[model samples]
Target chain A: MNRGFIYDTFNVVQQNKIMLVYQGEFNQDIAKSVLAMTERNLDFFGEDVSVKRKIFNVMVECLQNICKHAEHSDARLREAIFMIGMDKDTYFVTTGNHIANEHVVGLRSKLQEINQLDKEGLKKMYKGLVSNDKGLSEKGGAGLGLVDLARKSGEKLLYDFSAVDHCDTSFYSLLIKISKNKIIQ
Target chain B: MENLTIKATDDTPEVSFDTSGVMILSGRSLPEDAASFYNPLLQWLSDYGKSGVTNPVVFDMKLEYFNTASSKMLLDLFNELESVAKSGVDALVRWYYPEGDDDMQEAGEEYAELVEIRFEMLTY
Candidate 1:
């Protein structure tokens, strides 16, 4: 008997202690549902209020990044994948999406720039971006989602981009870790 | 114009704009379409501006969590209030954060830095 990709993915998620996995078209409605589910899961686990808030903040940015950046494939196909996993005292939030090849360079550079920054560096950059009148993106993002994710999680962003079979496209995956002990502020 | 009052929902905040020159926004604000939800609030601000609120407009913001989209809308709101203040009406913002939530506190501080309004931070 042979297991398919779905089976392998499931196995990997379970092995990684993923508490939730969502793969499909991501829109605002779906984001709301996912947040609600995470909220309930956090409550059930008796997580502290501040921990829950941190996770929720990071989750919003991750989901909205998918909604704002994911390449549109077939209207019905899965455009992205999101997962929340916990290992010991750390919780990991990961989002994977397809992007046009043309966007790969810019996205990679931006992530690299963010990864290189310390917390103070990121904070200064965030303030600069927010205050710069000319910095607003067409999507109204101001390119602050990733920065906020880093600032809130207080962790380096882990990301990867790989070429896909389809021409001019690649799959982009981003992982952020939040510690239970570092709750709030 | 009539005062505006919107009840809080899981994804939206409770908003109250009284004719007495008081506005309060409390609860979580993670609306699906933040623009749609905030546009009316902005419009109300415009109306309040024209109404010539002689009394100081006190805005109490006690939000636990808000998404990035809401963050942008908040800047817009503060900018509007700044304009209203410039027009000779006193506008003040009281930003409330949980005792230990540094992120929220920092966020409030950031907003204060971006706008010209009189912004004060309070811990709950």
Candidate 2:
């Protein structure tokens, strides 16, 4: 990793009004602290209570996704990255983690499926999953997190995947955007 | 069954179930190990189901936020209650949301549509 590149990225993040960023192992303790910091930051910025709650809900889902699904390999692979930022009236929550390459196809397809649904369709999907006796994955995920994120944000889920060198794993990044103006609708 | 009460934390909700047939769960629920946190509650509900509760059971859910795992556990809880209701025990679910929080309201509505028990939406 180039030292100058890290500095440049820091500069870019600050310029973009990024609220919070973390790159480390995500456990219960870290999740709690990150949530607290995010809450305080939202209050400091005087975001609307409804908007703040939406961002907070999305943050919890993203963090739990990292903790539950991030592929464990070496110490570095165990680490995940999360960032929350705002541009204009829209808030963005993003998370990136290492995942087994074999899992990428299913995960990508899930995201696409969620992105294709409108609000009503997402609601129906959520109810159907919740009522399905066999919906829970082996990881204890009900597979509704992405759908919930999309429904709450009222926006499509954006994602990207890249292969990691010398390993059968890839870095998966997901982004959710919540627009203040569209929230009331 | 004796009443069960678990205080809320940064990531778990406060749970209160009275023998008088009133249940209340409020606050955020984002537990790291959702099974560890919700298993006991599920067991309590199971016991309640067998405890000859003929009185009207009221469930008040005022959750601010919950993760996907918690959502699954919640569904399980509601399913248990639905069975109890079907067995001739009067059961009612009151889902509360903060004024202007459409997502939370929608969450309650979705749960209502999934289970067979009666549900009412309240704004606070």
How many pairs collide in each candidate, listed in order?
2, 0
lDDT of 2 by residue, B8-122 (tens): 9888999999878899999988887777888888888778888887878999999988888888889889988998888888999999999998888878887887889899999
Candidate 1 lDDT, A1-185, residue by residue in tens: 56698899889988999999999889878998998999999999998888888889999889988887875656533479999989999999999988888888998899889989998899899877766655335664547899889899989899999888846678889999998877732
Q: Which parts of model 1 are misplaced by more than 4 Å?
A: A1-10, A76-78, A134-140
What does the lDDT read for residue A21 in candidate 2? 94
For model 1, the local distance difference test gives: 0.86
Q: Which ten residues in a row have the lowest lDDT in candidate 1 chain A?
A: A133-142
Off by over 4 Å in 2: A1-9
State the lDDT at B100 in candidate 2: 91
Candidate 2 per-residue lDDT over residues A1-185, each given as its tens digit = 67899889889998977888999998778988898999998899887898888888888888888878876868889889999999888889999999999999999999988888887899888887877888467777777788888888889999999989998899999989999898745
The predictions' CA RMSDs to the true structure, in order, are 2.3, 1.9
